[model samples]
Target chain A: MAYTKRIDGRKFNETRKMEAKVNIIKNADGSALFRFGDTIAIAAVYGPKPLHPQHLRNPEKGLLRCNYDMISFSVSERKRPGPTRRSQEISKVSEWALTPIVELEKYPNTVIDVHIIVLQANASTRCAGINAAALALANAGIPMKQLVSSVSVGKIDKKVVVDLIKEEEDYREGEGSTDIPLAFLSKSGEISLLQLDGKIRPKELDEAIKIGREASKEVYEIQKRALKAVGEEK
Target chain B: MIAEKKIIKQKVDEEREGKKKKREIAIPGEKIVSGKEYLPGDGTVREKDDIVARRFGLADISGRLVKVIPLSGIYMPRVGNIVIGRVEDVTFNGWILDLKSPYSSFLSVSECPRYIKGDLTEYYDIGDVLACKVVSVKHKSIDLTIKDRGLGKLDKGLIIHINSNKVPRVIGREGSMIKMIKDETGCEITVGQNGVVWISGSKVEDELKAKEAVLFVANKSYIEGLTDKVKKFFEGKRGGKK
Candidate 1:
């Protein structure tokens, strides 16, 4: 059922307009919400002060706890609210992607919790959540080394795509193309998270990664503006 | 010689009267030390060797001058305030709403005395404004309770966005702005710094006015002399009801 327009009317390397909001939740120590087309994620930060069970204390830097959740109505099919096995794994990877970007050493023996609520899902909700989590951490006033941003690039019908929207994913699946999601820290130019759910040629994979990096770097600007806008509003 | 003496007396009297000219503005919570008045829009000023204090309890991070007023007893949730929340959530227990602060509060259905059942989709949806009491403030989490009249799911209304830090300004001195918006628009507006504002009124136009009024107050909250601006916005408005 994929069509020529399934890849969208844009060039293969184009990405949808991305926007972000910071300090969106008044009660969150730090909070942010990110939007990429139809996908939306709201992230909140709390901690860097105390630890549970005392044994969980790091004694050095703050503990990073990340929980990824999806509302029932986020997807086309209503998902029962709670963590599935896939969500749990995604949460772990998200925490790892964010751990190094934050200056946890500045908050010794404390805990910083990152909660990501996926309000809508298109194709790259997890990656979108990663970026939102970083913004929320900064919004919570949690000292951070730098902001983390993410994007997805894939190959569809032998054509390299920078950011894949939902229809693109569907079309690629029909065409037997490769899909990969990547998250990067803009400051260090480091790849914090990489996931592949489809097949692609090795050379095509490299191109996808290159596109992902560039897209993430660009998305970083949106993250910065969101935080800055929140401050200006204050 | 008699006319010259009378003219000199009148001139001296006029000069003395001019020196005593003073304007006394109402200082609600501040103790008047020397000067009886202040310049309009003056938030921070020095007079008679005494620093005129601002009206807010928190130090002005904006570094602007504000008139001093007594802090009222009403609870106005701030952006970073560690407030108590209750379990307004049904399934997965209620997620604690941290009151737009760093600490997370719980909205656990399990915390309640009764057992909630079914798919639980309709019981407590998103943006259900519930009043919760803060129980603890550890870095681990914030404990809260919703077993009070003030705490529960909110019904239909308008949710307005405003700066959480300026919540005090929107409410005004002794709820002056809040009362005005409520009286003028005839709508009940509940503000959440998390940017979830619930405004309830039968009239759609009233709700819109209340929203605009909130955004207005939120922007100019720190500046002095805002009553007239608010009054003017409400005057001669018709169409929302029609």
Candidate 2:
């Protein structure tokens, strides 16, 4: 199978360059802006404080609330105004990714709200958001067992690709184009969140995991540099 | 990409000045770029990715700040601080509000002069918008007032929740954005990053337009010159000049 793309002569294994800035908002306990290729996500972390009565609160551990919002102009076509059902579902999945890494037991009966705003939607933004949010939490000085880093693996033309930019994502076929997004606790080497949106053979699936793991090393470096710069600024 | 390029440039500079710069003990095969390089007296707890002295233990990579210690406690509400809230209970005495803060506040009935003596139930019912004020806080109880003309129930408007910390950004330097929102929509909009917003206007469309405008500001709070964009939106709408 052949695939056509909008990008000019970009390779299948290439990843968009990514960089992140921490403490972008001085007022937030932690904040970060991450850019991967054209995808941009800004995340902020607040609290370890009391949860409102309206929101369900866990008695044994702290509650983590995540909201993923994209501006109407984030993509080439304007997204429908207001948070869509898809956004809510993504927000829920994001919390799952961070729950294992965060030391929620340390802040019992409190809440930590993570808000991610997508400024651009070139590709793999959910993964980008997860990475940015972990940095923001660390920047805020929140206690967490380890940082969570994420990457995407997909199959194109029957060959697997490490990170799928927008053009590759668009050209991907329904059944064969497999994409698996995984979040890892860099310290524990544990998978906190995993999602698969396409079909793949059993062997192919294992290959996807290996690809994701290796790509995570790069993401982990990005997170470390971002945090190190934040520490230096302080 | 820019960040990585900069890192490379920094490394090259550091290597050129290599004065045997105190090599902290490192794990033989542990990845270097992502490892946490901690100096002595750094108090952070070690995690796996952290690169620390070998004697610190193979598994210990967390760093703790030795000097900077922050005491955690209840968050106090400050005047001019934006908050998010809900109307919990209403009374002849006042409306009890939940601000998601450690303290809850009350909005006095007298302060709401526009609320006629009729069904009080009809004008502003329970769970109405809580854009009132914190007149006082004593013994963990808060006294609230909505006496100002724009401070009542939100008839029809949009409510946005910004980072309670970024309220200042939404407000801009010297009360600019808030002032523009008022001038543009001819509607009253209240912001409480503590997460309550009250908007009221005779026209639902106008109130909604005001909400959209405010949300626009909230989304791009980081960008420069947001006031112009909001003003343009208002101009495009107000005169039917589209």
Candidate 3:
């Protein structure tokens, strides 16, 4: 049977509820918390300070280093506490997603580190992590061209949708699940990150990109508000 | 869709300016003001007929210039700025000073007020704190000088740290806030541009009060009527002592 309706009783294009807040980690240069329904991610930013290891230093520009890890208890299935292969891959991708916006050339030989921790996982943990990382960078007052927002959008059994929660991701009927996580730059609306798992046709991928791009604008709105909220108290 | 985005942007800008009478907060890539009428200042960048914020900060618009006062960030060194640094190493020719920045600075013997007779440690020993001037910030190293007046090794007292961004408020307008703190607590206070503060007073109690006052100003740097509030705070503290 065709997937005519959302299993969760939501609109096809609707994302899960989201909340964003900034300055959560006091000692960190910058920090933020972002929640996408059941999935939650917290990120902290440090430096534009010196980078260790003589080889890693770039005299022409600075480096953007990211670490993404899910806590052991974040998922029902136990996750290893250390940097697993999956976490390492996500960390590298997160750096690429964030690097487009940072004015790296201004801080030559320094490194800005972004640490993203997934506290809870339903689905789209990387989505939440990327969103939190962007907010934390802005909170750190690192000069950036714009913010980055991410969302997962693809076919859950042959239907293009935005922000698939766990129930939707588990769909086993028809064409099965195709998860595509996408990141968009707030200013240029450019695609900085795009990753897909499972099978998808070229035409179906087009539909997913269209839906994901629009969904990311909502994430950008929340992130901007969170960054501006503290200063608005004045 | 692009045209529609422009309309939405116009609407948002209108709503922002309408509520903003004083103290507007700027977000990264957010337009501080549209049009070439305003020149972009520090913490801001120019973007196609609009002045945009490059950092998260307070939007300060005055006359023809628009700048953002950053609320948070590590200190970026600049030439001609006075900073407090701890002498990390007494080198063969100079002392390597830690300015709390990523880069370690050098204070050479030539930069000192007196000619070195013996070892460099004889002048400024390792582990000593000094208020020095930034003579140069080059690609490989930063240079410092102690020959400038009121810039030299600091003696015993207290050293407090605050965000470098709030150093302007700690000093106040024309040295007003710092002057008040010095007069009230009878402390010799030096506000460093790199956020390190040195306070030396006759009594330990006075030194602590001065430190508290400086922190108070740093904490409330964005608020209006800040000087008056600080004065009231001082009055209350003095009464508590009595």
Candidate 4:
């Protein structure tokens, strides 16, 4: 295989820069803003409050809902303001990824909502949104098994790379490359989310997951640091 | 029979000793003990043969019961707990009050007073702050009563909302923290179990000082030596004022 240079010159296993901050919103119970390279996402958590509408109430456990949206100007092309099919799919997957960690049964007959807004999109906005939402939920003081973190891994220029950026994603998509988005529960070392795009052999898929998990550990460290900053008064 | 009784007594003593050593931080889904050995308590649940934590908190094992004290979370309303609420709306039967919980509490007109009952709004209009006790709670509806002594219609005071879970910290162990704040600031402070705080002082400076102290505790509740830190803060403020 010929050597192909990455757009940002990152190594195959190297991840993009990650920055996280918790408690950015005062009114919301918990809030976090996270940046992965150039992509940025903000998440706010509300509730563990009574679930509205009598029919929606679950007698035994709390309901966890997530809404993922991208602002019109977030991408190069102006996107719509409201929820799109892509956004809806992201929202559903994000909720599924987070549900395993939250102690929903502890707050029975209630609801916990996570709202994530993508301010910028390079690539892997869903993964960034997941990270932000997990931090926001933790900041809100919602009980959880542990912080959840995620990263996108893809085959770019015949090389597997962690945390792909926009150009790499586009480049890979054009060439029928494979992209895998994975989320991990740091404490339990379990995969809560895994979405694969395009086709990859079993060996490559395993390698991608292994790399994604390792990158999520770095993300988990950043999340813990952000929570610590908010938990203690400096 | 005597030997059997002695063996049972020894087992109970061992369980108590085990409980003392079992206290530690727990995360959700982490197993604390076996269900056969201990009954699941607050912040914990039984799953199969194990008792697991339901939230991030401290696991408290006492004899045959295991519970967890949550580090932080929304306030779950309970009967007989005093709470500070703001009247949000006027209903025919009662007034809807925001107790800062997920569920809004209701203060029925009947719970207000026995006599003087023309219009309930006239007695407690919208946006009126009151200190009341939770009489009962069913599902999402909570019933409150202000008929008790030192409860009802907060007229003049600064109301600050903090996380309800930290209310215990603000009150401190044996009411020591609240007592210290009141004595040092010379302000009357009432902490609602629902996380609402009312502070009233003859002087505006004193009220502000007390508010600051309460906010400080809420913000830094996770820190160790909090009592001493609060005391030092009050002392510094007094010296600066002089």
The candidates' DockQ values read 0.02, 0.04, 0.59, 0.33
Greater lDDT among 2 and 4 belongs to 4
| Tens digits of lDDT, candidate 2, A1-234 | 455442446565556687988779766777888888788999998876667884576666788889998889999998997889989988999999987767677556678989999999977888889998987776665655567888888876577777777766666454446667788778667787778877777898788778788778788888777755532342
Judged by lDDT relative to the true structure, which candidate is superior, 2 or 3?
3
Q: Across residues A21-93, which tens digit of lDDT does each residue of candidate 3 receive?
A: 9999999999999999899999999998888986999999999999999999999999878989999999999
Colliding residue pairs in candidate 3: none
Comparing 1 with 4 on DockQ, the higher-scoring candidate is 4
Candidate 4 error regions (>4 Å)? A1-11, A50-61, A71-83, A157-160, A172-175, A186-191, A201-203, A221-234, B1-53, B57-71
Report the lDDT of model 4 for residue B76: 82
Give candidate 2's chain B TM-score: 0.50
Ranking by lDDT: 3, 4, 2, 1
Quickly count the clashes in candidate 3. 0
CA lDDT of B191 in candidate 1?
A: 58
- Give the Å shift of residue B98 in candidate 1: 17
Clashes of 4: 0
- In Å, residue A121's CA in model 4 sits off its true spot by 2.9
lDDT of 4 by residue, A20-107 (tens): 9987998998899999989999999999887888699888889999999999999999997998899999999999999998878767
- DockQ head-to-head 3 vs 4, winner: 3
lDDT of each residue in B27-46, candidate 4, tens digit only: 45568887465688886778
lDDT of 2 by residue, B216-237 (tens): 7765654557778777878877
- The C-alpha stretches of model 2 lying farther than 4 A from their native spots are A1-12, A172-176, B1-242
- Candidate 2 chain B lDDT trough over 10 residues, lowest sum: B53-62
